[model samples]
Target: MNGSEVQFWSFVTAALLMIIGIYAIIFMDNIIKKIIGVMLIGDGVNLVLITEGFKPGGIVPIISEKLYNQSPGIFQEFADQASYSLPFALVLTNIVIGASTLAVLLGITIKLYQHYNSLSVHEIFKEEKI
Candidate 1:
């Protein structure tokens, strides 16, 4: 497939992931499943960011002084071919943040499980007092 086709499919996949995540969050009774749903949504967002940064047959965004000196006109060409760095950078930062957030969420889940002896949201919150 061509670049556009691939990008379009990637977007479709990302949307599917997010939708499934939402479904799990709303319909699943298990707290762990809900947490996994949130993780799925984050992964979908990451996929989209990566897709947005992708360029067909792209090169790394790097330029050497010697290479630039050899060809003054190559800068524009390089710029055109170089996939965006911002999206990738954002995805990286998001991954780190997401991991930390997931850790905290799981930690909370463990405490809730211990207190209630159940992973079900309804069971944990049925009292609605804690």
Candidate 2:
């Protein structure tokens, strides 16, 4: 309900997601599951970053007419109430990179499945000659 409560919940949710992702990665035997875990981890990190930049009673960091006309030196004061844009930008970049990474991992997984006729990492490694 309040700012601190929201931040606390956001952090809790992010930590839960990251924990699930790590559990999947460490305990799941399927290559696909591992890939999904990696994606979950990425998403959790993005969530945390976005939430970290959240501001209570904040507005977008845009120079609106109201802000511009407030005072000659109002920009500095307005900045205090503006949510940071860097986290959002970083999240966007992270999403793009995560997508690319997932694509590559899926491609590799597909090839591995084709060669091994299975998606289980344990099985694949067991079949490896060397």
> Which is the leading candidate under lDDT?
1
* Model 2 lowest lDDT segment of ten: 64-73
Range of the 10 consecutive residues with the lowest summed lDDT in candidate 1: 121-130
RMSD of 2: 2.1
Against the true structure, candidate 1 reaches a TM-score of: 0.94
Model 2 stretches astray by more than 4 angstroms:
64-73, 127-130
C-alpha lDDT of all candidate models, in order: 0.95, 0.91
Model 1 residue 10 lDDT score: 99
Q: Write the per-residue lDDT of candidate 1 for residues 36-104, one digit (tens) a residue.
A: 999999999999999999998899998999999999999999988998889999999999999999999
For every model shown, what is its TM-score relative to the native structure?
0.94, 0.89
Cα-lDDT of candidate 2: 0.91
RMSD score of candidate 1 (Å): 1.4
